[model samples]
Target: MSEPLVSIRSANLFTPNGTRIWKDLNWDLFPSEIHALIGESGSGKTTLAYSLFGLLGESWKYDFLHWDVLGYDLSYWSGPFGEELRGRSIFLVPQNPNLAFHPYRKIKDQVIDFFRLGLRSSEDPKEILELWKEMGITRPEEKWNSYANGLSGGEKQRICLSLALLGDYRILVLDEPTTGLDANTEKWVLRAIRKKSEEGKLGVIFISHDLRIVESMASRITIMKEGSAIESFPVKDRKIEPTTEYGKELEKARRFFL
Candidate 1:
């Protein structure tokens, strides 16, 4: 196996009020692989997503016995290097797509600004347009001029995915990225994601509660419960259900597994 894109062992995260939100977390993700983190709400899945790029704010404290992401040791993550790695090396697509863009700015302008930041390796507008079309945006040229408020939820999600693909990021963290999409749109989006991950050698951290989608997309999965990882396993060719009691419960709830 190639080197992991992210590796964390004995990690913990605490809120500003000193309440522990994550406990003893151990996780790993490798290049060109889709690793799914699945659990119910408040399981700290999204918190883990934000924690990858150290976006949990100063008040929140995070500690890891071994912390590394995209070849950088993040055990003592802070300062200029931390600031530089967030959007450039590790790109996160928030659960709420609205958080990704300026509400008042046109999408075209924001794309240009992101390009100018030198986060992405390529500056080709045509490539961006190609991704838009692949994401099922008809007449992406016209959509480019519209504001964030103008696009539908699915469009916003796809736009964020496209930006992540175009950027130079090695790891893409997606938090409930397919939430608002219809079945057909979801299919297209997933196809595009698979294409990009394989072609670009991107490692994807897919956090979603929907087991059906998780089963379809993920090569491996980690089950989280109350801020802890209970089990992690390969899903591609396994005929039996997960071994852990919690994982069995999850499988029962989902009614099926790959």
Candidate 2:
């Protein structure tokens, strides 16, 4: 069996006020697999994503017995190694796509700067255009020169994903990628993500409350509730049958709407 891209055991996260929010969470992600984190709002799914890269800053506290990602020990994730990990090994797509860009900066300039500064590689304009095309962006040349504010939410989301792909990342953490998108837009966005994951270049950590999307995209699933990963299983033949009560309840809720 291949080694997991990410692994955690006996992990806990506390709020700034020292209130325990996440407890005894254990999870694993493998390369070329889409592992979905499904739960309700305030379930600490987003916090788990943020904590992976130490984005919570020094205020929040984490107690992890074993935390490893991309072959590095992230038990103390706020140090120099953590700085090296962000945008390099793991790229997080925020719930709000607007947070990924500056409204005033041209998309073309920002992309070029990223390749130059972040990767230290000479970026080909054609490569950028091609990447956007793969993300379902129409008329990449025209949109390239446009400001972030000019793009629609779906477009910005795709743009953020394209930028992340350009980085040297092994894992992509998306917090609700299809949220607020029209049905058609959501379809293409999901298609693009699926295509990328199927390419087997990296692993994806897809965090969403939408079980339908999770069932459609993820090869493995982890059910989280009240800050704990209560159950984890492979999505055999695209079917999810949870063994835990909370997980069964979530599946029941999903089926009720269907």
Candidate 3:
């Protein structure tokens, strides 16, 4: 068995107003695996996505949050190192494309800016255009020069995914990335993701509401609700249903597990 790339154990967080956001959350990710995080909206799935990249602002306090990545003990990464690691090691494709770039800026410029700040790997527009084409963003030339507001929701998402893929980040955090995408487009996107994970040895935290997609892609599943992880099980496990309340709920809600 491969060693885990990242591990979170007994982590707790709270809002600034002292409202508990999550309690005793535990998860593990191994290389070349997809960890699907599924939950209803407002269930803190997005918050967990941000937390993985150390992007959660100071408005939230941690009771005892710690993460171990690649056998290194990173203590919540509250400093410059954490911020750097956020881009270099963990890339986040936010739920809202509106938050990823300036509305007036061209997609090319946004990708350039992200390339500069993140990974610092390359700035070739050709490579960027290739990624755009690969993600099924048609007419790369037109899409590249278009402003964020001009593109539809699905286009914006694929563009975001393309930009994230340009980097060599170890873990890619995608929050509801396939929303608003048509079935064929969504399948293409998922196929691209699978290729990245298998060929690049990348670990992904794929957050989605679609149980079918999760069943197909996730090597393991984590059930979250109202900020807490209630159930976790491996797809390869012989067990049929999750043992926790939320897990059982999910079991009843979706025809999971083959």
Residues 93-149 of candidate 3: C-alpha lDDT, one tens digit per residue = 878877887987787887887877866566888888887777778898998898988
- Number of the top lDDT candidate: 1
lDDT (C-alpha) at residue 96 in model 2: 95
* lDDT values, one for every candidate: 0.82, 0.81, 0.78
Best by TM-score: 1
Taking all chains together, each candidate's TM-score versus the true structure is: 0.90, 0.88, 0.87
Instruction: Give the TM-score ranking, best first.
Output: 1, 2, 3
Candidate 3, RMSD to the unseen true structure? 3.1
In terms of lDDT, the poorest run of 10 residues in model 3 is 70-79
The lDDT ranking, best first, is 1, 2, 3
Better of 1 and 3 by TM-score: 1
Alpha carbon RMSD to native, model 2:
2.5
Could you list the CA RMSD of all candidates, in the order they appear? 2.5, 2.5, 3.1
lDDT of 1 by residue, 17-112 (tens): 999988889999999998889877889888887777667778888777988877677543455678766756777778999888899999989988
- Relative to the true structure, candidate 3 reaches a TM of 0.87
Compared with the true structure, what per-residue lDDT tens digits does model 2 show for residues 1-258? 689988999998898999898898898989888999987777888888778777888888888899888777764467876776564567777899988888888998987876765543578889879877866789999999999988988888887777655666678899888765667767766777777776846789999877888888888988878899988899987788899988888998985432
lDDT of 1: 0.82
